[model samples]
Target chain A: MRTRHPFTLLTLAAALPTLAWLLPAPAGALGTAAVAFGLAAAAGVRRVLVPAVVTAAPFWLFLFVLHDLPTTLAIGLRITTMVAGFVWLAAVLAPDRLVEAMVARGWSVTVAYVFAATLSAVPLFRARARRIVEAQRCRGLSPRGSVAKRLRALRALALPLLLSALHEVDERALALETRGLRSGARRTPLAPPPDPALERAARWALLLVCIAALVGRLV
Target chain B: MNPLTLEGVEFHYPATEAPALRDVSLAVAAGEIVALVGKVGAGASTLLLVAADLAPRITGGRLTGTVRRRARSGIVLPTPWTQLSGMAFTVWDEVAFGPANLGWPGREIARHVERALERLEIAALAERDPATLSGGEVQRVILAGILAMDPDVVLLDEPTAELDPAGARALWRLVRVLAGEGKAIVVATSDLDAVPAVADRVAWLEQGAVRAMGAPDLLAEEATCEAGLGTTVAGVWRAAGLAAPYPLTVADAIQRWR
Candidate 1:
C-alpha cells in the first residue's frame, strides 16, 4: 500500500506537456475539448466540469465578446483538462506514497515533507472551514442571507479559519521538530514501496511517448 | 541517577514584563513520577517545557541558570490534535512517526509501535484514521506516539485535561505503568485527586516558583487545603479535623482505615 501505482502519476505528469503541444493551433480547439472530456471521464472527474464551467464563465464571456471561438474553446478545454488531471492525481495519490516516491527518488526529506504537507492542506483547510462555519452558525450568524450579509458572514468565517491556521503554524513547527525533521538526518521509511520493474518500464515508456507526441506536433 | 535537574532556573518570555518561571529548583530521579500541580498561569507548563528542553529551544524565552535532562526526553503537549501527523491516514502511521524519524530499523519501529499501542490499550485503533477519532481517542493515540519513541524521560502537560473521569483514570494508570518500567515521568496537571496515586512526589508551583515540594501529603496541608489544591481525600480528612499529616487519596484512606 505504501508503493504507488507509478503509471498513474507519471501519466498525469506527461499529460500536461501533451496538452500544451496538441492544443497549440486554433483548429485544434475541438481536439482539446475531446481530450479534456476523455481525460475527465477516465479520471472519474466528470462531476468537476460543472464547477469548472462555472468558474470559467467570465473567461468564456470575455472570449465570446472578442469573437474568438477557437481561443475561447481552447482556453476553456485546457483549464478543465489540467484541473481534472491534477484533481484526479490528488485523489488517487496517497500522501504517504507521494512522500515515499519523492524520498526514494533522492529528493530531500524537507522537499518530500513540503509536498506531503501541501497535499494534506486541502483536508486540513476543509475541516477548519467547517468548524468555523458551524461555530459561527451556533453564534447566530445566519447562512441564508442577502448577498452583502452572506459576504459578511463569509468574511467572518475566513477570519477565524485564517487566524487558527496561523496560530497552528507555530505548533506545527514544534511538532515537526519533535518528530526529528532536522537536516543531515537519514529518515527511515517505515513502509518503503516495492518497485516492480514492469511498472517502472511502463512509466518510462509513458514519459517517452508523451515527449515524442509533443515533438511530433512541434515539427 | 536524577533524570532531570533544575538549579535556580528562571525564565522570562521574550517580550513579557515578568518572568514565567522564577528560581525553580527540583530533581527527578529515574523510575520516579513527579507531578507539578498549580493553577492556570502558575508556570507549571513553563517548568515542564524547560525540563523537556523545549522552552528556550522551541519557544522563544530567556533563560537563567541551568536546566538539565540526563536522558532523551519526549513531551506530550496538552492538545493531542496538534501533535497529529497530518500526512498519516491511519493511527499506526501516526504512532510510527517518531520512531521513523529516529531512523530506527523497520522491525524495531514496528515492535515499538505495537508495544505502545498495546500499552495504551488502543491496539484496536491501530488502523483507524487519527482525524476521525474523538478527543479521548486522539489523546491516547498521541500518548502512544510518544511511548513508541521510547524516550527515557517523558513530560506531559495537562495530558488528561480534556478527558472525562474514566479516561483520565486510564491515562494515569498508563503513567504509573511507564514509571514502573523505569521511565522518568514528569507531568503538569490540575487533577489533584489522581496525583497522589500516580506520582511518587509532588511539586506545588505558585506564581512561577516552587512553593512546596514533598510527598503527596504536602498537598494535604492546611495551606494547600485553603488554596484549593487539596485532593478530595485530603479535604475529607481536613473536614474531619484530622492532624496535619493525612491521606491524600481514597486508597490511602482505605489502608489508613484498616
Candidate 2:
C-alpha cells in the first residue's frame, strides 16, 4: 500500500471522505470511518491512529455541545473519516513522489512546487519553533509561571517565529526560482512513481462510486 | 570569452536608498575561480547574486549595468536548509532536483546526479533524508545539487560557513575541481586561508565596491590585512611585525621560514 502510486493513494484518501459525505449517514459514515481508521492504523497505531483520533475527538465534543446526539453522530463520523483519510495520506505519501507524479503528468512546475512546499512547511516550521524556544530560554526568557507570564513568553516566542518564517518564505521563493522551478517550465520526473493500469482503473472506479452515491443521495 | 561578465553594475534592493552593490565590474572565464573576500556588509553576497542574474529578477531589486551571461548559471546560497528544494525525500532526489527542472532526460539526470554525489563523497548518503543530515552534510548536498545542473557558471555564497575544518577543506578542493571542469566560479567567502589555494583571483569588496582585485597574493597585502580581511597566516605575520610581504598560507609561511 505504501508503495502504491501517489495518485492511487490520493484517490483512496479522497474517495473515502467523499463516499462518507455523500452516502447515508450513521451506517454509511461508520463504514467509511472504519476503513479510513484501518488505513491509518496500517501506518502506525501510535503515530497515525492515535493522532487522528486525538485530533478528531475535539470536534465530537464540540458537536455534542452544539447539537443533539443523532446529529452529532451523523456529522462526527463523517468528520472522522475525513480526518483519518488525511492522516493516512500524509503518512503513506512521499511528497517527492507526488511532485514527480505531478511533473510527469505535465502539470506546471510552479504548481507542483507549491504543493510540495506546502506539505514540507509544517515540520520545517516546527523545527524552527523548537530552536526559537531554546534560544529564548538561553536568553533567560522564562516560559513558565502564571497565565500572564506564560502568555507573555508565548508572545515573545510567536513573534520571532512568525517574522522569521515570513523572511524564509522570500528566501525559499528565491531558492526555488534559482533551481529553475519557474512557472510554465517543464520538468523531467527523475523517479515518477509507477502508475499501473489496475491502479488507474481503481481510481476511476472510486470516482464513479462517489458520483453514484451522490446521485443516489440526491434522488 | 568569459562565461559571466558584469561591467559597471549597480544594484539596489527595493525601498532601500543605499545600493547593495556599487559600480562592480568583473568577468569570470571558463576554468577560473574568483574569490570575493570582504568584511560583513561588504556586498560579496550581492555580487554573487548579481552574477547569477538573481539580484533584480528574483530579489525584486533595481539594477543598472551591462550584465551578460553566455551560459547557464546556478547558485548555492549561504544557508543550506533554506536552499533545499523542499521537494526531495532523499539526498539523491535532492541532488537531481535541478537537472530534472532543466528537463533533461532521465538517464542524463541520473548520470549527473550520481557524478555529483560521488564528487561530494556522499554516495553512501544518497538514500538518507536531507532534513536529517548535519549542517556540513546538507551543505555538501546543496553544492552537489547545483553541480548536478552542470551550469557553466557557479556562484557560491559562504559555502563553507557551516562546514568543519576538514569538510571546509574538502569543499575548497571541490571548488577547484569545478573550476577545472571549465566552469566559471564566483564565491563569496570569509575563509581567506582557503582562498589562496582555491581562487585564481581575489576581489576585495569594501562597502559594495571592488576596492582591489588581483592575484591570490592580494590577500597578503597590508591594506587587506588592516581591514581584518586577510588570511590567517598573513594576519599573524603582520601582528608579529614581519617583513613587507606577508605569506598568505601556512605552507607559504613555512617556505619563507625555511
Candidate 3:
C-alpha cells in the first residue's frame, strides 16, 4: 500500500473528505470516516489511528457542548475523516517520492522543493522545539507550577525557537541557492515512482465521483 | 582563467552599517586549495559566500565589488542539518538531490550519486534516513550531496565542525583529492593543524578584511601566532621560548629539533 504512487494516495485521501462534505450528513460522513479510519488502521494504529482519534476527540467534546447529539456526530465524523485521511497520507507517502513524481511531471524544481519542505517541516521544528525546552530546563527555567508560571516558561522556550527558526530560513535559502535550486529550473527525477495506468484511472474516477456528488447535492 | 575571483569585494548585509567583507581580492585557479583562517566573525564564511556568488543575491546584501564565477559552484554550509535539501528521505536520495537539480539524465545522476557516496565513505549509510544519522554522518552526507553536483568551484564553510578527528582527517584528504581533480576549492576552517598539510595557500582575515595572504608557512609567523591563529605546534614552540621561525607542523618541529 505504501508503494502506491504518491498521487494516487493523495487523490484518495483528498476525495474521501470531499465526498463526506459534499454528500449527506450522517450516513455519508460515517461511511467516509469508516474508510478513512480503515486506511489509517492499515497504515498503523499506534502511529496514525490513535493520533487521529485523539485529535478529533477534542472537537467532538467542543461540538457536543455547543450543539445537539446528531449535529455533533455529523460534523465530528466529517472532521475525523479529514484528519484521518491526512494523517494516513502523511504516514504512507514519502516526501522524496512525491518530489520525484512532481519533477517527473515537469513541475518546477522550486515548486517540488517547497512542497516537500512543507511536508517535512513539522517534525524538524518539533525536534528543535524539544531541544529548546531541554536547554531552558538546563538553564533552570522551570516549566512547572501555576498556569501563569508555565505560560511564562512556555514564552521563554518559544522565543528562542522562533528566532532561531527565522534565522534557519535565511540559512536554508543560501543552501538551496548554492545547490542550484533556482526558480523554474528543470530537474531529472532520479527514481520516479512508477505511476501505473490503473492508478491514473483510479485518480480520475475519484475526481469524477466527487464532481458528481457535488453536482447532485446542488441540483 | 581562474574559476572564481573576487576583486576588491565588499559586502554589507541588509540594513547593516558595517560591511561583512571589506576589500577582499582573491582568485582561485583550477586544482588549487585555498584555506581561509581567522577568528570567529572575521568574515571567512562571508568571503566564501561571495566567492560562491551568493551574497547580495540570495542573501539580499549590498555589494560593491566585482565577483566572477566562471563555472558551477556548490557550498557546504557550516551547519549540516540546516543545509539539508529537506526533500530527501534516504541518504542516497539526499546526496542525489543536487545532481538531479542539474537536470542530468537518470543514469548520469545515479553514477554521480553513487560515486559521491563512495568518495565520502558513506556507502554503508546510503539506505539510512538522513535525519536519523549522527552529526558527523550528516556532515559527510551533506558534503557528498554537494560533491555529486560536480561543481567546478567548491566552497566549504567549516565543513568539519561536526566531524570527529578521523572524519575531519578524511575530509581534508578528500579536499586534496578534489583539488587534484581540477576543482578550485575554498575552505574556511579553524583546524590549523590540518591547514599546513592540506592548503596550498592561506588567507588570514581580521575584522572583515584580508589582513595577510601567503604560503602555509605564514601560520608560523609571529603576528599570526600573536593573533592566536597560528598552528598548535607553532604556539607550543613559542610558548616554550623557542627561537624565531616556528615550525607549522609536528614533523617540521621534529626536523628542527634534530
lDDT for residue B190 in candidate 3, whole number 0-100: 92
lDDT of 1 at A152: 84
TM, every model:
0.87, 0.91, 0.92
lDDT of 1 by residue, A1-219 (tens): 114564456575456636544746544544554555455555454454444445546766777788677766777656555554454454456667667666666567777677677766778789778887788789998858699989987888898788988888877777777776666567777666667887777777767766776787779
Task: Name the regions of candidate 3 deviating beyond 4 angstroms.
Answer: A37-73, A138-152
DockQ of each: 0.58, 0.73, 0.79
Per-residue lDDT of B139-182 in model 3, one digit per residue for the tens? 99999999998999999999889999999999999999999999
What would the per-residue lDDT of candidate 1 be over residues B45-158, giving only the tens digit for each residue? 889778878788888979998887789988888887777867576899889988877888989999999999998889999888887899889988888888899999999999
**Residue B224 local lDDT, model 1:** 91
Best by DockQ: 3
Worst 10 residues of 2 chain B by lDDT: B52-61
Query: Which candidate ranks first by lDDT, i.e. highest?
Result: 3
Ranking by DockQ: 3, 2, 1
Per-residue lDDT of A135-182 in model 3, one digit per residue for the tens? Answer: 877899874799998888888888999998899999999988878788
Model 1 clash pairs are none
Stretches > 4 Å off in candidate 1: A1-11, A21-66, A137-157, A201-219, B237-246, B251-258
